[model samples]
Target: MTALFDVILPVFLVVGFGYLVCWRRWLTEVAVDGVMRFAQNFALPVLLFGAIARLDLGANYNPLLLLAFYSGALLSFALGTGLSFYWLRRPIEDAIAIGFVCLFSNSLLLGVPITERAYGPEAMLGNFTIISVHSPLLYTFGITAMEFARARGQNLSVGGVALRALSGVLHTPLVIGILGGFAMNLLTQAGLVMPEGFWAAVRMMSSAALPAALFGLGGVLYRYRPEGEARAIAMCCCISLLLHPAVTFGLGRIFALNLAEMRSAVVTAAMPPGVNAYLFAALYGVAKRVSASAVLVATGLSMLTVWFWLAALP
Candidate 1:
């Protein structure tokens, strides 16, 4: 219990502090937006770049681990979309947005800190590996689905849809960082070494990634107050917090993943929908309320759900 609290509370407390600041009007919404922009576009990307650049890709890039985590994410997306569209009677676009909420977990903000606290820095290999392709893969899938849905009865061709999806994925700051890191990694393999001073600057920025992002995230969620769509919100929370991790766990066991691999897969799978989830909805102007509310509600519920998963993990 102490360990669980240690792993979870500090993260949430920082998030809570940001919420309090926003709730009290200590910072304007514009200020909060600036903070998030800095964190997401600059600090967090640099962190990913550093992590990926220094990663021993040959040793840590486990296909089985990736399979378990991503398979669960895709499954959750399908279920969330199908249920929202068919059962909940949402518009096709809205269904796609809600599915994105289930698809993109808070892998960086919540997953990294919790897993690091529970295991150690060495365990980050799996997390970073997953993160490297995470945004690109999921965003591509989500965008393709959304474009297809939107393009129905329009004159848009299949190639046009694929091109737009690919364009969107490539334009992401996170994906740019990952691609740059991979390029750097390759250069390093070719006997290139970055200077210590350069790394020092990278570390400085990387250090601010999580705290700044988490705090800004709280403020962002404050704006997205839980309004209507109670049923859809509840479904998103369940799928993101419970079902996704369960599927990852089952797959991990089937693949005989080692303890570190299992922990990384399940913990990352278990994170609430990321701020990106809401961003995706906002970008498309569909189901924004549901996406935003899911991020807010699911994050609050993750405190207990993450603990349960940690305890249940082998």
Candidate 2:
């Protein structure tokens, strides 16, 4: 309980401060957009690079741990997707949006900073690994799901879709950053010398990423007004905050994860609905209302859910 309070409460306090500022119109929408653009294009990439560059991905890196986390995430996403389609009887696009809402998480925005505070810098590695492994899944299968729903009657070719998907992954700053950093690490492991100046610059830039990302998230939430899509959003928030984490906790224990790793897995699983849901919705012309609503509700509720998880963690 003490651990939870100590670890999670402060994060909520900071996020709450941002929300208050935006709610009061102290931070204008223009300001938020600029901030998000900068964070997404620059700050996040630098952070990913720096974190991955420093990773000692040698024999000690646990493939099983990565597999466990991936399996849990995949199962949760599948269950959510199936439920949204069958139980809710939503249109394909809306179902895809709900599926992503349940699956993808704001691990970068919320996970890294909070984990660093709670468990230290080393814990960030777990998040880095998870993101790296899941990036391909998100870019390919996730986006395809959205496209399939949106282009229900369109004659979209498989080859064209594959090419576009590959291009999207190649163009994404986050993906590039992860790959770049991993490549750098590999080269360094093979006895290449990274310039001190480059490392120092990346380190400094990366330090700014987390706070900026959080503030940007707050700004996005401010722009999102939960007027109509309340029911769908609420359902997604329940699944994300409750069902996902519960499953992760059970499976993590079954995988025999240590306390630190289990905590990391649980917290990651409990992360807010991803910003990507909104992005993908716009791209695929899905249930934009529901996607936006999910973002707002999940982010708002994450404060409470995170607190609960922290409190529950041993």
Residue 284 lDDT, candidate 1, scale 0-100: 92
lDDT of each: 0.94, 0.76
Q: Residue 164's C-alpha lDDT in candidate 1? A: 91
Candidate 1 lands at a TM-score of: 0.98
When summed lDDT is taken over every stretch of 10 residues in candidate 2, the lowest stretch is 59-68
* Clashing residue pairs found in predicted model 2: 4-310, 4-311
Best by TM-score: 1
**Positional deviation of 203 in candidate 1, in angstroms?**
0.9
Question: Please, what are the lDDT tens digits per residue for candidate 1 over residues 1-314?
Answer: 97567899989988998999999999999999999999989999999999999989899898999999999999999999999999999999999999999999999998999999888888888899899989999999999999999999999999999999999899889999999999999999999988899999999999999999989988888988888999999999999999999999999999999998899999999999998999999999999999998999999999999999999987
Compute each candidate's TM-score over C-alphas: 0.98, 0.91
